[model samples]
Target chain A: MVSALTCLFTPLLRAAELQSSLIASALWSGDSHNFKRQSHQFSLEPEAILRFDNRVKLTALMRLRSISFDGLAPQRVSDAAYSPLGKPLYMGNSSEFELREFYLELPSDNYYFTLGKQQVVWGKADGLKVLDIVNPQSYREFILEDFDDSRIPQWLANIETNVGEWDAQFLWIPEQSYHVLASEGGLYAPTSPLLLPQAPPVGVSVDVKAIDRPGRLLMDSDIGLRLSRFWKGWDLSLNYLYQYDNFALLYQDRSLTANGPHVTIQPQYRRTHVLGGSFSNAFDNWVLRGELAYFSDRYFLAEGLSDSDGITKGKEVSSVVGLDWTGLENTLISGQLFQSVALNRQSATVRDKSESTLSLLVNHTLLNDTLELRLIWLTNSNVGDGLMRLRVTYEWQDNLKTWASSDTFYGSEEGIFGQFDDNDRLIIGIELAFE
Target chain B: MKYPRLLSCWVGILSTPFFALTGLAQEPLSNAQATLPTGGQVAAHINSRDEGEAVSRKLSIVMRDKRGKTRKRETMSYRKYYAGEKRTVIFYLAPKNIRDTAFLTYDYNTPEREDDQWLYLPALRKVRRISAADRGDYFLGTDMTYEDIKLETRVSTADFNFKTVGNCDVDGHPGLHIEGTPKTQAIARELGYSKSLSCVDRQIWMVRQSQFWDIKGALLKTVTIANIDQIQGIWTQQNINVENHKTGHSTSLSFAEVDYQSPVPDTMFTTNAIKRGL
Candidate 1:
């Protein structure tokens, strides 16, 4: 295991106080669709942070996951969009070792620089993610795993400095990596039969294949900017980003074959411009936050068009408003409203012109704060789909916790939650961190 | 997460104790009270003493159940007070599960407004806005309620009538007893208190002990302060304990590594800093 090898370097790196933790968790989950089909998963996460006296800081994190099941099916290749790392790599069912973050930070009086891969979180809205961009995500587990673990880090350069009362952050990424979709036939993948709306009839023998993403690092680079300040109980931020889409759009590559007409599926990225802003204010017993972002030249998949693949250009505006109240007895209640509107209706045909979503969270403590009861509910008004998750956690110590949770979804087949209506699961896991 | 910081309980966002006696409080005093200096004179003297703009300290807090079982928590804190503005941030350093949890609070001098607070939970990877109301709600099941902790800010001279009870020796210091009752039924219910009693150290004008009485004339709780020391030129209480008679529960807060006017960064007192973690 890499953990063994990393352990060897701990002594050499800890002169500046190396901080590290090893977290392992397992869950037994049963799908609602087939009660008889059950699966188990075990994951281990090892992370470490070191700050050198030479004004440099380094952090490394890695995760290994394994799954075991009874009557689990094989990976389906119906859609070539399946992620390579998204599929389970098994000795039975273990994942290949994944290195999540490895970065160096150099700080100075006037400016500070960060080089290497990292996750740059930008929003204050809980669960909304209106402005929390800058990194791609692996939605293989949907929203079950915390973003700290799910948000894929990107190789980039970051610089920040304070000019008078304003703080500014700049980011430049040399390589473009797209979002990793759930593996085909996996738990969270979209499962449905579709009919191509318009297409030329193809000989049953004709074959279709995929071409990978662009390999040249400079061809698809990303850059962003953020300006922020805290004034009079309010924290405000303005942002701009030019990045590739996390989800790829498919385009048809024509080829002449001996059999007849042949098509090659190629993933395409639409260079997008995102302009965003965020604000947070703390008042008596209440905290308020709002965020909004506008996207130019956003791309949309041409759903229902099976014969020929095409990508459409559109625009979008997304916003979130959230609040937290801690007025009750040892209870915290938080809620957020998210709404995204397609600015260009003609090009954005796959989804509705506007979609509104709501999320609510309630947490209460009992038994001298040793036990906590928490519930979160999210619903989309456009699709009439929603998911409710409940969790009970007991803290044995500061660094250890054991939890049992259940996630249930309700919706139509084409909806986000509807597609996985039968994949509802119960989870129990233990996590411990040490340094 | 540090239970205290995660639950935002007993944060001890205390202001200068000497200044707490300046406003409207009521009641008449005994011979003991007559022998001591007036609250005004005592307050003026305390204010004139050496008080700095900031303070930092380590804290060991313990809460005990009725059965005498105890839970211990530890934290390090930095606080800065500037005229009408105050900011404090506390970091949980012990009881490892809650270690690295951080809490930030902003206290405003405006009367109609309440203090602002935020909590960072490493587990959620999020800093949450914690809304606190000075209601009769216990802090993380501790004996001291939010109302009890906000004793100074929630009560004013216009709401209560104060009087001197008598001379008394509090924690081996010469002190004057003071009793205050809400001026109206509404004010009494709002504070969940009918009467408040306190013993003030005559020399330093600091509150050495205090007791709360409910509307039904039953004793609710009593708090004691001890281990006084002059740190950073200011009189500081190193240990404070609270006993809730009705609930039979108690909480004790002990201070250590106390530092005054230390160079705590202004950035350390903000939510952004709290989110960044220790």
Candidate 2:
């Protein structure tokens, strides 16, 4: 399918002095847990890119993952055994394989257009908020189960135009669906149930009844405006986004009731509306950024639910503020504070819990950008827990690229009659991208 | 913004010559020797002076391809210096990612002249040396080449026939307009300005503007001196506008702030400085 289009477009690109290239890379990682259990993984990521004289570009990316773990059979091993989310998980390896990005872009003198499967980030949340953009859902994750599979629209089209000092964009998602949690053996059974520390970890189950029948096609649209200007030695940017989605209603009808070792819930459909604003400014080697978002009712609604009473109505507001200082030429220090609150609840029936997080990060470069070091300290106010992560990366162009990191989580609650000891996880990997 | 203000001031200064020579009566000289030598020397001196000083504080240059889309580049640098027995650096500054890069030229007049350059990288805490022949190449990533910033005296070795066109006000300052043309083919072809015309201020003998033309007499670039300010008794141009007639793309440099007489240590221009990280 893509070959025919490429053939048709090749002559036009050649006439326009455009260029295209393809790159393939492989990455491998090995890890040992408590100096005992060990795992090894490998992945292949291939990408093709096209560049036009007018700065227009198109890119397609594919990723394949294969992993193996010692001391455990493949059927017996699950993501829950390694982390909180009881789903199949892999860093650089996954049993599933899929396309990452298949997007086409047409950037002209004054405007740009993009259409296809792609990731769109609205705000700067890094990886610690409702809007955190740590990873986009890959094709493999679509066929498998992973907590990282949050949102990936099947069809999307976006247009951006600049008028004077203002840059505006309008995005349309004709069909969007959240990945359904794969059933362990049944057609649509919930694999892992949300369990409290006192609950049994294995046999405990959840019965999620589809009120509106889970997966329904819905339309979503977002409009954004950004104003960029320079003032007194500072570069300032202010932006706003308004989003509307129809799938919100479905997600609202879902509810979970804990009954001994079993739980049952119904998923409903609801309308979702979101409004957000952000500001970023840089002055005298200092950068300050802030963002606020308000989600109305059905922020993450699934499809097919009963909205007869419309009792499930509320709003969620999240805000984040960050500051970065670049006093040293090769070093940077940054910190961010984030808070999320559920507002205007329908009644006391809805439990409104606010989550606050603080993060501190420091980064430095060495050996002329060949080596880099990053350290992050994160604390969650609601969970009364802290996490520290340290990562070191080394790159020698096409020769070798390696990244080693360790994450330590503290204050984890006891689970299933066993104390959840602090987790000290370490990962090291190398990537080769030559030829 | 500063360049615009200085440009208006220069326009005022150049306008005076148009009125003074045509409006006021002046004695006409009959002997060619009486007017040629001094007038030619003054013309050359003015042109040389304007080219000698580095004009501009910081400039944002946008280079677009034939399709009018700007290209993204990692870095760009510009440097200028005076030519003499004792060399003096006129300007040494690179933008953003190219900062801390420096270039030095020696024996600028001779064919065997040499230029040594270096770039300091903060991440490595080291400076790397560059070859002299690279002068003709693009400076870092900008469209302007190293040769563009370094004045080539061989181009101005022509035996010039100078005639005072008139007096005019340039940026509100009074100045004279003198036209010079090469007397011999050797000088004409060497300078590449055989058919070009230059306007000079009589008092300071500073070339305020120069209009270049191709061999076929088509206009190329009209480089106008936009600002001339006095610094430590030495007149320096603070702004310049190079307008390409064909492309309609113009680059303007305005020196928002400058220190002309600042004590620049000799050690600062050494290869050691580049190695030790500028």
Candidate 3:
């Protein structure tokens, strides 16, 4: 079927007009405290875009990655993270040959149509997630990679049209996919106490059941709509999404059987309705951005030591306001303040009623932007846990770059960043691309 | 696209090898351009000249350092007029890393009205609103400032105090030399320039060369225009080069495939168009 379609479309596209790019990179990181080897990663990505005179466009991307720890033999990695319905082809324990994005765009007079396996992004926040959750993400690297690299593409249909002075986007995602988490024994697996379950009692045994993933085609699909307009000097947007939450909730059932106090744990995704709005405006050399969202029926883990279900439900509101200053030469300074609050808090809910975080970013370019320096700091106000990253990148030539970076996490064991404090590492990588 | 009053002068200035003010129907200078034109008259003449109703072209920008290492960026640029306001959009076409990135700007003729700009980054799949007030900042790692790229041969009459100095000759073309100083300290700080000297070709009424001084009163850079062409009966600047005197860095721009008669739609100047890429 694929070859037939390619043959039919081949004559319409000029060979010379097909845009292609190939990128190869090698990265190595070590434990900052122990100075021990952590992981070495190598990746290759090849992408191609074909455009016809009739305005039809096609894009395809293939990615290959291999990761090993301390130069050891490749470990057997499970494919559980991928959606069962749209899993890509895997080759050995360390290799994956996947068609990440194979989308065709059909544009009309005032409307645009895109269909296939693709990623759609919607939000105004920088380095944060709010209304940008149209597609699921991969936590394999724990939010360290650029969002473009971490967002998992899905089979979906997108339509964009101009309505009066506003732009409207409609999305229909049939692929049922959730967050891809790191393998239990993988290098980036989380060991944070807050995220882990308590140890079973001395006399009790714990049994974990397989994740109950939604498999229905139409009933379990995701849909979204976004409308944006530029009025006066401000850019404003309204967004809505009806879909399953990216993260699953743990449901526990306890019973006293012949095995004596056996606990069964099941993970299931819950549906939620999200409504949000964002606005941005620039004043002189400073730009102000803000986004707020309301989530209905979010699930949280219970704090009670002896709870039957170990789950709590509540409504939540998340908001962020940011500012960017470009007054300095070749330098950009940005700061954001974010907060999330649970409206109807439960007495036994493990999650706090209100949580706040602050992020600061500074980027400076030197030597005609050949050499770049960047610093990112994110701190949680309530927990005093935060992450800081300092990086330097140099452009050796066109489409070639070399970079070095250090990631440091601080906090107590139970805190989010504190859980990875010992995993701090320095990374050095070189990437070269050919077009 | 032709103004009858300026047609004779434009034809003679562009078709000839030299822009000499000799042997032409000696038309009297307008009130603004008296026997000795003031600096404002020269600036106004350059800004009001008719380039085209709409223009599209492929622009190549090359930057070189003291060590002779160079980087080149190529883009497709489109400019159109909406009512009296001007709108421009540029899309990057080469260098795979930055490909699919686009920038859109809406420039207002009224100096007091702030211009609106947006940059679409493909990597982030987001369109960011950017301020146009940082006109003095260098653009895309090039020696040319944002203002230089925004206003090619025109001068910002509101920001500067212009005075006619004397007669000057550049590249064998007789021209008028004008000196400009910032109108106020705030303007100087915003423009990052203390003083400027410009040479305007008398016949064509276009800036041929300009030298700038930094805010600290030190020689900053020199920009020279070349390869003037008459495309569809409109005078266009095809080649521009700027050299930073203090940093020993330079940038050169060459416009290719220039077209003024092509149909450039108003929709192409919108944010949605840029987000779609070329």
Candidate 4:
């Protein structure tokens, strides 16, 4: 898709003012579960910009990543890469060297158009995403990775223009990318009890006979619109999106045994509608932000269901409130409270019907802003599961830095984060930038 | 997306002038108010040649430590003037990591309200309003504080007594010497300065050299301006060097690609411009 755009915009950009930059980083991680190398990763990122006559700008980014696990013979290290290969009918993940952003922006007096692959952020929440759902996520490395690396870009066209002091934007997305989930048997996989009837046969193999992917038909695409305004130093925005669920839903095909049934789950996609809005206000050393979203026709896996009929449709409402403060000389503290509620639904598949989450981030820089220490903590209230990450970095030069980091997860195995409790890790990394 | 911790540094740097420049351009001048042209009026006159002037320039910021070791940053910047209303915006250019960061400021003539300021964070893809200003904190890891670059025009009238102290020479150019004494001892202490003196070149009417005395009545800093050039008939200083005697450190701000009195756009002063990174 990007290649096609490049071909079309090439002639216009050939003589454009050119600029480029490259950022490279490598990381080594060891785990507490077993004192062994848990991850080896190398990443090369390059960004290019071409500006023509001050009217159009093309910005592109390419990310090349290579990751491998410590396959120590004595003991196999648990890792996402250790997952079992998917069934015959599957959407595989081999997207290294992918284009993170390849978009051309055309700006005029009052309107602007952005076309090609891009990430459009729509919400004001921090850590907990409520309405910033314009792009899918890559969770192959779990949620420990920054969203910039996790966000999956889509091919789209965005048109924005102003009306008085208000701004209006329209988006049309033609391509959809699925969220990158962890492989089957990777270290971050569900352990003991989460190995249930659905994820059964933990050590066994499963076969897929059929699959369903997001449609490419124009009528079957995603569309969105947003209107925003800043009044009295406060921002207010309203957004609406008609799109598909980022992940797949499965339907069991049971006909193998008489009376007793063998289930063959068939993966499929569902359509959804999202309506949300955000607000933010900054006052005296602190900025407050909040987002509220409502989802219609949202699908949920029927708890304890054996057949593909497990996918049930329901409605949900989610909200997040966050604040960032810099009252101190070299310190910043931020926190957010997020909550989601399953609307009273016809589907009996709903379990608790409600969930709450909390996130906290603290950052401080010292030594003439050359050294920084940051910590992020997030937890699920209902399941009592939480994840904590810490990083300490010191700048060696204006464009070079080194850091040590750690990740810890704990709680009931029933929680998303708690399932990876045993996969706690420590990492060391360095990154350098050049232009 | 979670923003990189270091990105906050750029955010801080972008907000410095926007918040500090509040009411700085509107010096509220009246030819009759004083026995002589006041500091506010004089500083305002030196800052520009006409209203509604636009400028595009390349700025170099160099920071030096006690031992004279230096660190530098370069920026591509544009300033669009809003007539009657005092407003300006600056955009960063180089240092790949900090590129495209922008700052927008709206200065008001009214002393009752603070300036309207905003910072655009590329990583967050959001333009946020900045409501607070820390006058004492350093700007972008540089030796200069926000108050220093703010020009102190808004407070010049009420906080200090200005007078033509004497005749002085700067860089071999003849100039009128101007001395400012704090109106009160407490006001002097709050500003961390006992007194300030500036030598304004007679031809350009802009300060050629300035000296600051610390709270203890000792030399705290000395600033020298050099390389006078005429860009669009405006006498512009090409290089400014500020040395802090107490810290034994210094900072130099140099300007290039000077374009004065160019056509200015009204939209350039808006928040949308910041988000566009223009």
Candidate 5:
């Protein structure tokens, strides 16, 4: 299906006088730990926009990525008590180089249509909230390693239209795999343990299994309104989205012990809804912004579960406010506060976590346009944690940029009564982007 | 007998009172009009150098929903300029909660005409650049561009037709309103004012007010000048207000204090100064 669309769009793009080029490179680094290593990558992404005489416009992106990494073996079990009775597990480090994005878009005066694999960021993502980053989730160990290229679905179709200040979009996802949640509550966990029925030590030998189900189809529709001037000094925006997922489910009732009581679970076959609104205003030296959002509980639970019987059922509401003072030409001071809460008790069971954070950031330029520096400090009340990061970026030219960054995270949990060492990380790398 | 007659005629001419009075009246008189400078010459001098400061009051309005309910806020600020020197200070006086916040910006005006701006966040004790392109796109998100802050003094670039409309009192000072228009399309686009007209004060030769329009002739913004004053013998416009009619938001500047001839060190605009937060 992807090839067919490419074949069809290739001719159209050629006829429209479209042109594109691609470039890529790779680098590798070794760690003193022997098993840990890292790699550097470079890519040239260029797109040619062509407008046919018929007023039909076609655009395509020629994307590429270079990957290099160290070869590391998977952790081995040293004790027989915890080791699984199977062929000794042996996993090796692997890396691949490939083109990440190659897609064509057809846009008319009022509407646009895109077909092929593309990176899609559904919700507002600032490193924290990535509700719908549905491409391939990179299993890479380091965050920077995953930055080379994004995991995107093999097939996708999208249509967008704008009427006045309002915009609407519809997305279709075909042949996409939903991420399977592991029995252990971690982003990436080791393979699950298999237990026989009616085993002893329920907590100790409750075998867990990792299931790879068939891919499913998904669809989402979004509507947005632009209210830039409905008021005296405020800018407003409102958006709503509805998503339908097939073969998407949550593992609600997984028995840790064999032959344990059956855990009533929520079904997986429901729709998810999200609604949000935002406002922005600037007065003299101060700029103010705020946002309010609500997500239906159905989206957080298993698909087929009844609202009344589900273990976690309810709604979530989030609000944020920020103020920025622009007293100096290149200087700005800002403060932000945010809160999220589950409305009902049933919802609170699944979303009982609430947090508040304060952050300060400063950026300045040095050596003309050659060097730039940024410093940031963030503190969170919930974990009593604090983070500080310093980054120095140098831009050699339009195509080349490099930065050295260092970050430290420190925190302590009350009642835990233990001192914890601050986790410190340093990263230095260069990037070359071309067109 | 002829020489004697010629000598008598010369004597009678020297004694004529009317001729003597006419010579006295022809002498030049030094009055107020004679002391006043030419408007064109004054404009050239003001545009020759790029260093000044101004105070301002800004009003921002937000309108939401189909019903059109509006929210408005106002603030006061003190601004200083060193032209290409790259550093500026803005002190906010109003809004008691934000009085302590002072903004200091460092600019890197590249040869490409792209300016990189950095801001010092006092509370954060850090300096951050104006990273986002959209941050400098508008004046407080209004129609005013960043270039607007550096008023265009290039009069020769535009085909100006100056017509003294009438005499009027502006802030207690008598002033003349002259209208100017761009003569060519290319020049209009370069100035970022495709279809705009300006009113220049006849006395001080300063821009009193200007209205900008789109190519389709729709009003985009209206910039007005006020508080005309003399700072260290240099005539200056102390306040400027730019209002976007479509958005109901206005960015006004008041020059709290100014010094045109103050000596500013060249080292102040360098990249090192920006890093040191000087």
Candidate 6:
């Protein structure tokens, strides 16, 4: 079937510049108690672009993933959300294929327009996101995957123009997609106590209702606007977004019956208003960047099981400050401080009023950039928990590269990173590109 | 990104020496010329020369290691002057892994004010503001540093003290040799160079060959121009080779499809235009 599809598209693809990358990856559990092979993933990504004489461009990107596992299989076959617009095709229990992006770009001297499925990114911080909340994300591999791989593209209309010295961007996203999460029993699912609900009494039966998602095409569309300019060596931006929150809000109902206690959980989407600003400036070998965002509505689960609706709503404020130092010859040292606060904190909320995390990343290129080493450390002040990751990549040739990486989590179970301690894993992968 | 100034820096950094070439005097000096040109005078001649209004070109960089392993990158670059400052934007056109990646820079003529740069990684779909302070850092595994690319053609005479090293013959052509040392330790540190020696051809007023010494006073690298041609009445360097002795690596740059008559629009220098790709 794949061969037939390829044959059918061969002629059409010939007119466009086509490129593909094949990646094979393996994961092994690093847990002391459960030492075993986790899963193997193979992915193929192909992109094609066709351009017209008038500078109109059409681009299409597709991805296919097949996973083989012993005990770490995801319950869902596809990595994308079940959207009314479209969904990935499942070939088997562990294989799925998706048309990730298909966009047409029309450009002129002063104005540009892009229409179709695509990803829109914003903000300045890395690893810890503050205002980069345009596209929803896939948490199937947690946050270990690169943002490019994890971000879920949506159908949108993007228009950009120059307003004097400032560059302005406006977006209309109609496809309502939300975060794709790992199944509860999956290896990489969230185990943090603060994120999970309290344990119910023994013999109690729990019912989960189908998620309530926004499906109206234009009516449920998201709108965003951003204005950015470079002035006096500083890059600055102001942004606003009106959309549905990526994560669902859970509402629970509990009832006592003759048999025992019964609980029903309903997940529903909620609207949010976001206002953000970011700035970055470079001095000598150092680049400093920062982002601040205000979210009008954020929902968190209540602490106790008996709490009404088991949810609390509050206003949220998030900010991040980052610095990158490239003083050393082939090395880059980057540090970022991220903080998120619940402005209207509820006493019964599961999370604290404020959470702060610090991340340090060091990347070094060696042997004419054929070999690369990277290390990242992230710690939270409130939880005293953090994640440490190390990766090494060797490029045998310009078109091929191999890498080995390890992710480690430490601290008490209640902390975000600490909850995934047992899920620490080592991954080895190879990527080969064909142009 | 005017091609003339493109060659100016290219000529200044790669094809010419740190000081003036007596050829710009419109006359070749005999064996016994009474007066010799200083480094500042030569730099001023190179800087003041007129090239053109705007320009675009295709650039190919080939890098090879001591082991004979080679990698190549191809880019489409556009340059134009906005007021007095020069703005350049380069878009990667080859090597599928980095295709659509772009880099933009605002090079200021002011000695005290720093320049600004932005890099767009297609994978991230974001334009990043990067510091222009690391002028000594190698650019994309190439032998040339950011300084080599930015400050080459218009050699900053104030940053270095120049002296005549005497006349010599380069490739059978009579040439003037000039030596330049950094004026201050801070400037030396920023440039990662202690001293530079340049051999300028007497006929073209362009540096035919140059050598640099590292801050530690060790012989670092040598650059030689292999080809030069007059395009649109401007002497343009077509091919350049750089060898880094310390790393046992070399880079070769060749420019083609040099267009000096076309209009390189102001819109091409914006961050938004880079994202649009070429």
Q: What TM-score, over all chains together, does every model reach?
A: 0.83, 0.50, 0.92, 0.82, 0.50, 0.92
Error of 2 at B264 (Å): 35
Q: How far off is residue A43 in model 6, in Å?
A: 1.4
Question: Against the true structure, whose DockQ is highest?
Answer: 6
Ordered list by lDDT, greatest first: 3, 6, 1, 4, 2, 5
Stretches of model 3 off by over 4 angstroms after superposition: A1-10, A14-16, A70-81, A305-307, B1-34
The DockQ values of the predictions, listed in order, are: 0.38, 0.02, 0.38, 0.32, 0.02, 0.41
B1-278: candidate 3 lDDT, tens digit per residue? 00000000111112111111222112334555446788878777877788787889888878789999887878888877767588878887878866777877888888888888888888788888877777667766777666666665567787887877666767877777777888899878877788887777888887777778889988887777788778888888787777788889988878889898999987788777888887
Model 5, runs deviating above 4 Å: A1-93, A97-99, A114-116, A119-127, A130-160, A165-203, A206-233, A244-270, A298-311, A332-334, A347-353, A412-423, B1-145, B148-278
Of candidate 3 chain A, the 10-residue stretch with the lowest lDDT total is: A70-79
Query: Recovered native contacts in candidate 3, as a fraction?
Result: 0.70
- Error (Å) of candidate 5 at residue A170 is 4.9
Give the better candidate number (2 or 6) by lDDT.
6
Question: Model 6: per-residue lDDT, tens digit, B1-278?
Answer: 00000111232257333432332222344666537776666656656655566778888878899999998888888877767688878887877756677877888877788888777777667777777777666666677776667654556676787766677665666676777889999888877788887776657666777788889988888887767788998777788888788989988888899898999988888787787789
For model 3, residues A1-435, the per-residue Cα lDDT tens digits are 999998986777554368889999998888888866677889899999988787788999988877776222222322454676556566566665667899999998888999999989877777778778988887766778889887889999999998998899999998988877665666556666456566677999888888888888899999899999889889999999999998877788888999799888998899999999999999999999999999998877777654578877889999999998888877788899999898774546766788888999888888777788999999888789999999999988888899999999998767777777777889999999988
Superposed Cα deviation of residue A408, candidate 4 (Å): 1.9
Could you give the DockQ of candidate 4?
A: 0.32
Better of 3 and 4 by DockQ: 3
For candidate 4, the TM-score is 0.82
Candidates arranged by DockQ, highest first: 6, 3, 1, 4, 2, 5
- How do the residues B42-131 of candidate 4 rate in per-residue lDDT, one tens digit apiece? 544544434225666677877677765566677655555454446656676767656666766665555445556666767677666554
**Worst lDDT window (10 residues) for model 5 chain A?**
A414-423
How much is B15 displaced in model 2, in angstroms? Answer: 33
lDDT digits (tens) for residues A353-415 of candidate 2: 476888898877653334678888877665565767788886544245677777665654422
Better of 1 and 6 by TM-score: 6
**In model 3, how large is the Cα lDDT of residue A148?**
87
Interface RMSD of each: 4.0, 17.5, 11.5, 3.4, 30.6, 7.7
